[model samples]
Target chain A: MKHKPRLPQGLLTTGSITLTVLVLFATLPGYASIYTVILLAAIFMYIVLTLSWSIFSGPTGYISLASAAFLGTGIYTSAIFGKMLPLPVVVGIGGLASFCLALLAGALTLRLKGIYFSMFTFGLVELIKHLMLWFEINLTGTRGRFVIVVDHITVYYVMLVLLALTILTAYAIRRSKFGLALQSIGEQEEAAAHTGVNVTLVKVSAFAISAFFVGATGAIMATRWTYIDPYIAFNYLFSFMPVLMAIFGGMGQLYGPIMGATVFAYLEEILITRFPYFYMLFFGIILIVSVLYLPNGLAGLIQGWQKRVWGARYVHP
Target chain B: MSILEAEGITKHFGGLTALSGIGFHVDQGEILGLIGPNGAGKTTLFGLISAALPPDRGVIRFKGEVITGLKPHQVCRRGVARTFQSVKVFPNMSVLANVMVGSFFGRPNTVSAAAAEGESVELLEFVGLSAFAAIPARDLTLANQKMLEVARALATAPELLLLDELMAGLNPTEIGLAMDLVTRIRDRGITVFMIEHVMKAIMCVCERIMVLHHGEKIAEGTPKEIAASKTVVEVYLGESAYA
Candidate 1:
């Protein structure tokens, strides 16, 4: 069958505009009342987290398993700082703290390649969790910390701004020389290095930037929830969920992680309510199926189908 | 005086000596051919000189400054670039993008995108792969892949290029084209140190030749000297064939 390769101009423009509107609407006073607004805010936070994960584990093939450690660092730093200072200042401090933590982690773990790198990151999260637990006396008497009640609108707007920044940064990096170096390193490290790329610097820089975004999102997350405990703040599941979303969308492409987070979040909301006990199992099965049949994730599957349907016309007439 | 000098370079892979007390010099604007049988350490010598691997014992001097033990990128920045026997072009990237990586990272003042793009286009045209510029590198045939490798190495603006088996898999026509390309590369005032098994291509383009047998230098001279050397003939054809 003959097919025409028509670019979906309307759909592309509308989809982008719709996403912007929806994001901005989340900051409105009466978008969906306070409860749904908070839920949407949480979704935005996940979007940032998933995209941050994509910077290293997705396109760069680093496969970090300790994203939660950076997230926790930001959450705890912001929560404690907000208790003593202004919220905006606290968020900035959170980003700095996370950057330092990531620098330390990167220095120690960047030398370990492939699966060893992954395991080192996994151990890092566990170490952070244990340290938080062990140093209970230093962390708000071990019961966790809380921020004084502030306007929820402030939290919403802060997260919105942060999300926008994260997306823009991801897009910029995707098109930059640094991005090409990262992709080359991911595909073949030895080749990239021989080609004059500083493979170590590129990998570490991506990891650090990835940590910055996830950490910033984690800071706002603590404020939005009005509490921060190491258990919930640095939950291993927090790291797993974003990695899953990134894999579910498409790891290497910019928009894939965001799409993955949206679909995964919506699915979680629907299925968790109905099969709360089997929710993790459902996630597991979906991951298995996705990995087996759609290795590039849902976005790639859709792209493949689109090409098959429309690409015929572009061939020799 | 030599532009590049390798003095007493020895490499050991545990108990195995890959290169033993090898010394050679490459004059500026000269094409030096390195020839050997398999496992004779031609590629390893390239690696050691290019800083892809550190030699166990060596002092490499470029422009009268020691460059031994420098990292590959640092060596490249010092005007030394090399290709692998196995082609190592960034497989998933477009041909232009692969060359752009070289221009952007190996050269200064290449941070501007327009300059990088222009230089990359020039390099692709120089290597006769301009028509395949937009194609992914993995799609190129072996000969084109080898050409792309050379093009990418050239993008670094190196003073000396180390090409490993640039004509290994090419047919006679492709070999002729590659030989002409190497000559043009030399004419650009860049020194060429090439490792090749294609005897005709090596003799046709190289001003001097060095021979390695089991990681040791057995012969070094012009092509005629090498072709007449009893040691070179015996090493390649064996004692029975030489007899």
Candidate 2:
């Protein structure tokens, strides 16, 4: 019988820590205040976005700013179908819609590399937002739509499921042959192609897969809003926040984005509640400091210290 | 018998004709060297055969099948693989992972992870990079990086390999090892089409040599005949000799 490959020690430690935290959070609603439950739900949403964004952009260095486009598509799907279908089916359709949109967008613009790719992806958000706006103004005869509301507990549970799925998918892809192709493409696309990677197909498929998570999260979160307009659904902050969180946490390990999104979301919550007027100013300062000093992100900073303290013998390098 | 053949290969980058009417064939299990002065379109010809760039006019046949207009990855899957003029190893990946990428995706059939890893390890040993398999590719010396690229290309299990300027930046010792590696590769039944600027390495290792000048083929013969050709000496060797 073939032996199963042993998991790396680092991965095992990380996996256990993740499971512990997940179990704690899974039971939090029973004992904690509703405020804590809601806040955790919001944190889960950010984690899903940041983790999914890193799934594609982290390894490929594509720097996509198109999360809002997919998220908004999911929001709209939920708005249109919330009353007709059940929650799970609606979320599935939302994810599928975003996947299709991403496939078309990726195939068209992935040929453009570096900053050009970023610009095109950012432009995709604005294009979709305006297109939805025009459709609402001209054809729908309505500007905003109401969504069917789910209980806060149900919303929290769904968000938890999504967070789990995103983590699992991201982890699985990162350890697979497909993930190696993505990294190779990022390092040297021409060489990767000559080495037998179908660069276009890999790029497009990853783009769509990442979008699936963002879309599903958006679908679940839409129920909490109860009503969403194009502006609310397609906010550009959704596009930028995930990128920042991933960078702040670290892009090196799977937990890097998870750590980043958790800290960033918590900070945002605290700032908005206590220092509403100056929250963004403080948030901006923290982001700048992290970018300037923690070049490798939080995980990298920790890894660096581990190497120094242990004299390189303790580290894998 | 020829394993790879190209005819009437022409490419134009705007107004500059990079390659024009270039015809060549790589005999099975032979090392065919291509040499020329700067801007002779040597790399461009490799690009056309490997499908990195399209030929405005040409038909390329591999194993008696037309492969003209196929994508680079498609060409690779058909058993043709290439290394870039400049080393293009995936810098952030481990040396073994770099080769694994090739073994996993280079073939028509899918490769299991364990099988890919085993093949990658063997290729790394073949290229004398077995000791450095776990280190990131960017940490390797330039010569070692070139060897890593060779290992990666070989992991694709190619029947025909195209190497562009494999010894351009290497020292004399490194060049000797690279030449030895090429011969070893040929002995293993892989046809090698190489572009080289090192006259000694090319003359000693290759059975036949082709010369290009101003995007056109100038001479085609055995290494001895090419060395004795007045036209080649006048245009290429003479310039190098003066320098």
Tens digit of per-residue lDDT, candidate 2, span B179-222: 99999999899999999999889989999999999999999999
User: Please, what are the lDDT tens digits per residue for candidate 2 over residues A235-298?
Assistant: 9999999999999999988889999999999999999999999999999999999999999899
The complex in candidate 1 yields a DockQ of 0.52
Candidate 1 TM-score restricted to chain A: 0.87
**Candidate 2 at residue A277, lDDT?**
100
Off by over 4 Å in 2: A1-16, A308-311, B239-243
The worst-scoring run of ten residues by lDDT in candidate 2 chain A lies at A1-10
Index of the highest-TM-score prediction: 2
Question: Which runs of model 1 end up more than 4 angstroms from their true locations?
Answer: A1-23, A137-143, A147-151, A224-227, A308-317, B237-243
lDDT of 1 at B29: 88
**Candidate 1 lDDT, B13-74, residue by residue in tens:** 99999999999899988999999899999999998888888999979999899999788778
